[model samples]
Target: GLKSSHFITPTPIQALAIPPSLARRDVLGSASTGSGKTLAFLVPMLERLYLLKWGPLDGLGAVVISPTRELAVQTFNQLRDVGKYHNFSAGLVIGGKPLKEERDRLSRMNILIATPGRLLQHLDSTVGFESAGVKVLILDEADRLLDLGFLPALRAIVSHFSPGGPNAQNDRQTLLFSATQSQDLAALAKLSLHEPLYINCNKPGEEGVVPAGLEQYYAVVGLEKKLDVLWGFVKSHLKMKGVVFVTSGKQVRFIFETFRRLHPGLPVLHLHGKQKQATRLTIFQRFSSSKSALLICTDVAARGLDFPSVDWVVQLDCPEDVDTYIHRVGRTARYQSQGKALLFLCPSEEEGMLQRWKDKGLEVKKIKIKQSKVGSLHQQMQNFAFKEPEIKYLGQRAFISYMRSVHLQKDKTIFKLSELPAEEFAASMGLPGAPQIKLFETSKANKSRGGVKQPEVEVDVASEEDEDHENVAAQSKVSGPSLKSVRTKYDRMFERKNQSILTPHYNSLIRHSSSASESEEEVFTLTRRDHDLPEFGGSTSGKSRKPLISSEDLSKRKLKAGGSKKGLLKIRSGPDKVIFDESGHPTTFYEAGKEAEDIARDSKLREKYLDEEKERMRKAHEIDREVARDKKRERKRKRKEKEKEVSKGFFFLSYLPPPPQPPPSPLFIQKWAFQFKVFP
Candidate 1:
């Protein structure tokens, strides 16, 4: 397997550590990252298992525990490559996979590479899964495993193994390896390293160091300028493949989203603890194979993972400690490859972090950012954030996460939250305003590191130089009333920004930083934009702008805007009375408000008169209707009488028809007589 993988001369750590382990002696190896520590321990491990002739029925022959799933998966892949010829059945057991699938095949795995939490969980719960017969144990990143944070889980895992055979010797051959080796590892861990051979290839007393081929540098930038500098750097190095290490998952997500939208001429990806397991693995694989891409991530990707052909490693935020910085840079310049690193430091942290690096024998070149090289993104960012509520929301979350991460830092000397320019940072992210954050933090790390002597009080952040809104003033003079009592973390959490959490340490100190004010909401800005600085910077256009209209038109526009009167009187007469006369016009009732009030005062009398008038009208209407009916009857009678007379005339004419004919013949003679009678 080694020859097929192009194995040549052995590395120094591997050369020394593998031989002792081959002789059945426990080994503790320490070396710089990517100095072939993985293969060093891995070679001995596979050889030991092969020599023992371990089989699938050995009840978990080897257990390798890594701090992260990425590292565990990596070690497993390498194990397969090294042991492909052997008949050892191995399986990876990590979180984010179906428990049933893992349990169904778990008992068959002769070798298991897993994270501590998952391993401990299986030991405590998985049926028929036993590690008592385990023969070998390997801890990758042993320093991380031995830290106080992970010590409890490690102890439980160690307890699952059979007790050391004799004189604290274990049933298994343990191999412990880490880049940062220290005596504190032994102090923190109990009996994990027996009378084992301690191999250290690094310089003694140094925790960690940069690779020989890695060029390290730092830029002392204010928190407000960090984003712009990072943008400028990424813009300048568009074709370079690298990782941007931030403090929190939210920060990673925000940067990834924002930069992706900006289209920085490279593929942008993000990985954090919050992503799904499948998503993380997919992203990890993509980044590893990608030629030119930028990965924004939290510390989840900082340790024990390797990417090929990476050109740069940018630490946008200061690392928690020197060890982290070493490992972060170790991701690049692997196997003697050349790489570059850049760190951003605020002025407050510059002194302390420089001293720390000097103590560790680490060297970094200090460089000033050139204004010509940097692209200011604050205006564009603010515009986008203002338009997209989603971006604004993400900006807020990222802001809070950043503040929380800074507050949670164990090294208070370097990670001073008060020194950060939160409002400026928000503006750089395209946020209209800085999201509010309160740093009332208390943790075991704080106590251990002496970070916050007491839980820090949170008040409206104003300019540190502004005495009017000082934290002391806020506490001393609360809005409503003063309460002389201590509040718990829960109480503090429910406490709104309006309420200030005061402490008994009323030393009346005016602590200030060169950057932003203490809290986010109380940021005190010292300068205004060129457009806003009329008195200071003059007009933004260099020459004053005059209105583009005639004076008369301008006056008309101004008059239209407000306070203009109509030429015609808008004298609104009182609303017409509800009652109307038969002529379809308004009644004569008074509509004046005072007259209506007087009428309302006499409403009882008016109502009585109205009722009497209504009754009288009803009686008069009945009488008129009866008179109309009588007239109608008289007309009908006249019509019937006329019809009867006409009918009688017609009957008389029919009976006297022959006599009329005779009378007509004599009419001519009687005509003269008729004429005389008519004249008479």
Candidate 2:
């Protein structure tokens, strides 16, 4: 199978990791992406099972865990291709499939390729799904598995198949592999590996951890110009297949939608977390199979998935760390193939992120963007946004998402919001002005990491298929933590201070919108205090903390002349508030009895007041009309008097015209005498 599929030689990671893995020794491997890491462990898993004379009756021999569904799918496909000569029943156990169906067949799967949440579900709930004889425990992208997010599920899953279990897979040989391996030995310790060997392909004083054939370059562009540089690069490399990574899904949609409308001479596709599993799979297949295409997506596509013949990797903003940087660039330059990566760093992000890359022993060359090559998209973006309101809305969302992502960054030195040219960035996105990010500035967006397709209210801009997917996304739920609370973007958008939109216009946009499951949204208040606040100084001992600026002290604080940026922007109506009650706080309809009566009384009084004002205005308008008529008559009379005076002067000049013929006497007499003589 390997020879038929053109897998000729073993990469460094495969050579090192395979040997230790086959020797029944635990192995923790770190290798650059696209270095045949998938095959490294699969070979050993197949060999071990073959050596043991394993069969279907053995009951779940091997379990491969990946951080993402795309990666899990990729691993399952690779396993099928290479392990075809051997008899092993492998099944992909990820979300988006019918849980009951998966459970029915899951008990029969000898080897399972799964994500953490779904696998844990089966381990805890599925009947007859035994892991007693599970021999090999492999975690692909182990760094992500060790992240704070996936840690809980990983711990729970590991607890199910530990060595002390009654039918444990004989000391459970474990293999952990990632492009960037986790450094925390304590976390790895929880996985119960017996004296794991760390196999890293990186050599001291060698060309960095990234693929040697990959050429890396970066440019110090201001926040506003990053998009321009990216657009220029894309336009220049229209024939080259590439992936452009942005910070968030909103940004991915904005770039893809707007750029596709602009017609960049290539097929453009977008992949983000909010998309449905089917839509994501379809897009993944499309991009993978295309002869030449460009993919604009968030970090969702950064890990283990492979793309053939990829030529370029463009990163719009600095990634959170070196690991992400490696994964993003690793998409290209596979197995000695040459590729290029371009990084766009803002003026504020350049120093910190550059030094970070350098500390990781990476030598990224600095390059200047040729002003001649950079195509100006400001006017084009502005025109589209100004005319097409859909484009305008998307631009606003993209800007907001970028700001919030930067604000939420753990490192302030690399992502300082104050130093960024936000207004310029807004303009570059084609917005007339920047939206007020007061909500993000003071309070974190507190976006829910789980549940609800989160298609994130990233309105499907153009495609009907994408629109359908987005509608399903609003109701679809995932298990980052649980299905109990899904943080959808519905509430965050309502709270955003979009100064560009009029009250009625904006209301109409969201008036008909619906959500199947309403996620918990951020709330603002003057009295309630949170421990995460900086003023509290990180004390969590149940000690009573003081509110720095309360309603009473608000008048005392010398606030700036304009509106204050300190207070909460959106607040849920409290019990004490008179204007509203908690029976579904006011939308287009008022549910509270008191509020309804109050509105009715106010309406009557307002109608009477309007009638009186109308009467007064009518009387005043009549007087003004009469004054204007008198002014017009007086001007007509003045014009008549001036014309009469001019006519009288003209008549006098005509009456005196006969006295003006005395100048030609001599010439006239001589001419008359000559005429008489000549006639005789």
Candidate 3:
């Protein structure tokens, strides 16, 4: 056996929560990553199973549900060590695995740990509680499950177990565990538990940002400087497993490519929702096992994942919201281990997020550094000058002709700093505190005075024309597009028609009634034979050729014809009637079948409830065999006394009184009998 000293000490969260959980009380443990929450629940669960003598032969009893497959596997492996002493059979049920294998294993397992979706799939199959006999249920990441919209499935699974009571058969214990208890999660808990005990460890100043183990760092730089600085930071952390969080999938690909090119030997891989589950799992396994220098990913891999050895987390871009920011920083500072976080801020999006972080009382280490000049290969390609060797890159006149063909207009709005060299341009123009240079603003009403006194209106108009031409040339230089694509002054007069009919007014204007007109009655003429015609000419056997053109028929036919055209021709037609229900969705003919099924099921449920009520009332008055056979002792005693009295009288009569005549008076006999009875 490994010594007790081999195990790491408990964190504050573990210290506070493990005891209550071991006593079979509910717990809501809220702490950031690397806070020892995994072991907090694991230790208590293992200890209870150990002391209670729960093993595989007892049938499947304990179930742990996690949000992701990877987290479930990690938790399974963590507890497997302690479970070894008692031969506890723990099975894993997650997606991307065969259902038959999970079902077969669940038939004779002790603890079945699974993700919600896969577990629900098994429940949808033929497997029942009689086989598994599940007793103890644990939701490892309960908040995540609710957030992922698994409440309906969770409720159905919980309903399978009998309600806990003294006479209840197959009563099971439920344990809900989560790092964060959102409102939706709390609502879900109410459905699963029976007045459960609530435990919270997320106290302010103690459970939040002020941790002693992890160090937080921040740097302010331009948007272009982030990747270069992040690459530098990753190169510094040589042996640690670090993760870089970018914003988008495109950014993920870009950063991954850049890192590979910059450092070939670095074991860096990117994981996102766009990748297949198999590919994601493979990358995660490789990254977790190896001493990968960095793992580049997005917010998709942020929550419900465990990486115990992650030493650092670098936020590539400031997240848009506080929750996203929290999830990004949460990757590190996990468990009882130490971690470091580095946040890179761009000039375009720094101030707002920085203030928000500061308001949250985080001692964010802000470092103001000069922006890095190393550009991405993409950016370099965008900025490089191309010189052709053919015909000595073309003579100057030939180049001018080519430029004219391309309509390469010159930027006439000369910047004050444009005269400076490339080296000075970045420092002089790029600095935030640079003084304001001359900026030209066209004055619609200004007139330049003559050299001495007269107002030069013609000169003013000439300067204004020059400015307009300069503005057009500057725009043309920035975007190298064909001149034909540019809008002419004459094109501005007409309003831009909303080419698509997908607007509220599209159906309203079908009759073209916007123009003023007197009331007029609409008329239609219909033929009986045309009424039998099929739509879209699907099938028509011996249909009459005499077409009747009623106004209604004309309108319907035109609408059908319009609907056949694809894309932009589609109309945003409103329903004849609007129906609003509890759920905020438009109820149209499309959902009629589903609504009918729902109504039928509700009626069936009501009938079931009524039957159950009748059954309960009947059972309350039921009498058993033991109660009906019980006799009264007093009745038996009285009967025995009467028989004894009669026997005594008979004995007395047989003794000697038969030969005696009526010799005594009635009063004397009565008195004598009374005396005799009293004496006896």
Q: Which is the leading candidate under TM-score?
A: 1
> Worst 10-residue stretch by lDDT in candidate 3?
454-463
Could you give candidate 3's per-residue lDDT for residues 1-680 as a string of tens digits?
11332556667777887887776665556665556677777776667767778755677677788877678877887777645666677788877766676666676677778887787777778454343366567787676676556777787777655554223465455667665555776687777665566665655642234335678887875543554566556655567788888655555765565456456356888887678668988888888787656888877667757765788888875654444555566776665567788887655345666666665656678765443433333332122212223212222222222222222112222111222232222222122222222222322222121112322111111222455445554655554333345445333222234424446665443454634222222234433343432333233345533333443556765646645644113333343555666787767654765776775679887687789989987776464433444445566787788778766765674464543566767776566556546224
- RMSD (Cα, Å) for all candidates, in order, is 31.5, 26.6, 34.9
lDDT of 1 at 15: 92
CA lDDT of each candidate? 0.77, 0.77, 0.58
Off by over 4 Å in 3: 1-5, 50-58, 128-132, 164-171, 203-210, 222-225, 235-240, 248-250, 262-265, 274-278, 320-324, 346-351, 372-376, 379-680
Off by over 4 Å in 1: 146-148, 165-170, 182-184, 443-680
lDDT of 1: 0.77
TM-score of the candidate numbered 1?
0.67
Top-down lDDT ranking: 2, 1, 3
Write candidate 2's Cα lDDT for 654-675 as tens digits: 4543434666576664554454
Global CA lDDT computed for model 3: 0.58
Considering summed lDDT, which 10 consecutive residues are worst modelled in model 2? 516-525
**What digit string (tens of lDDT, one per residue) describes model 1 on residues 1-680?**
88777778898888999888777667777788788888887787788789888877776888888888889988888888877888989989989998888999999988899998888888999999988887778888977765525677887798889864335443577888889876767853346656778888888667576678999999998888887888899989988999999988888887887788888898999999999999999999999999999999988888889888989999998888888899899989987789999999888889989999989999899999999878787887777687888778888998888888787777888888777777777777877677766554343544443244444344434333234335343663453123444444454333334324555332233334533344533565454323322222223355683333343434555535332334112222234456665777764566555556776689787797789999999999999999999999999999898777666655554554344344666566356434434222
The estimated TM-scores of all candidates read 0.67, 0.64, 0.54
